[model samples]
Target: MKKSGLISVVAFIVSVIVTASSLFTASGDPFPGPVMIAICIILPIIGLLAALISNKGALKFIGFTGNLLILLLSVVVPAVSTLFWNQP
Candidate 1:
């Protein structure tokens, strides 16, 4: 696999694990909705900035991985939140 592909896969897997575990933990509201949203939004931007700043392949991998993880978290967290919130 290319570096980018490897990074993306690792990021996806990590994000899935983190997101799943987070869903089970509760503190009053259970979901830290806005915080998750901000992370999702900010990570990609930071990744892009890293990509722009670095000339090394490893840095590129890191940025891509970060972006991928953020994207996965963005989708999974909201979906999970909706499912739990809407349950009857």
Candidate 2:
């Protein structure tokens, strides 16, 4: 579970960076952002859940907090920035 949780955390961070950074590219498209954001949310969530189930002490709380940050950063911020505020 620890190994799997670590893997999920890495995947989640990478996906979040890739997905969020895509917004700044010249070829940016809205088509893939939501899907990738969904992936980012899922990966960290899985890690958090696994950590909780495995009784890994600090890992569980840290995983949850980190996952929440990832979710906000990779999903909510981009979404609000694009959909609500008209900023480029």
Top TM-score hit:
2
lDDT of 1 by residue, 1-88 (tens): 2444444434444544555566566753234877554444553555555455555576566666666666666666768888889655
Residue pairs with colliding backbones in model 1 are: none
In candidate 1, stretches whose alpha carbon ends up further than 4 angstroms from where it belongs are 1-31, 72-88
Q: lDDT values of the candidates?
A: 0.55, 0.64
Clashes of each: 0, 0
TM-score of 1: 0.43
In candidate 2, residue 39 scores what lDDT? 67
Predicted candidate 2 versus true structure: per-residue lDDT over 1-88, tens digit per residue? 6665565456556655665666576877444756764666676667556555654555555666677777787668878878787755
| TM-score of each prediction | 0.43, 0.53
Stretches off by above 4 angstroms in model 2 are: 29-34, 57-62, 77-88
